[model samples]
Target: MAVVFENDLDRDGRKRATASLMSQFQHAAGLCTIIGSFTFLFALVIGLIR
Candidate 1:
């Protein structure tokens, strides 16, 4: 339910919403880090080849 919306009027709902947002942020950060590392490695290889 928190994936799209957190439709609760209680404090737990707000807490869950924050948790979901943080999880999403963490996931995106991990993905970005992986891609950045791969790209860096690729550039390093190309530099060595040239």
Candidate 2:
């Protein structure tokens, strides 16, 4: 989704907008990865405890 939006901005010749969108998308992806890892670890710990 973010990639598609970024591509559209790039096609429109909005360099700054494309860069901003790419940065935001990267940040969001990083956050999601961190959260997902933590959640998986927490679930694993709970399962092990049981």
TM-score of each: 0.70, 0.70
lDDT of 2: 0.76
Model 2 Cα lDDT, one tens digit per residue, 1-50: 33433444455676676577678878899889999999999999999999
Candidate 1 minimal-lDDT segment of 10 residues: 1-10
Clashes of 2: 0
Candidate 2 Cα deviation (angstroms), residue 29: 0.2
- TM for candidate 1 is 0.70
**Candidate 2 residue spans exceeding 4 A from truth:** 1-15
How does candidate 1 score on lDDT? 0.73
Worst 10 residues of 2 by lDDT: 1-10
lDDT of 1 at 49: 100
Off by over 4 Å in 1: 1-15
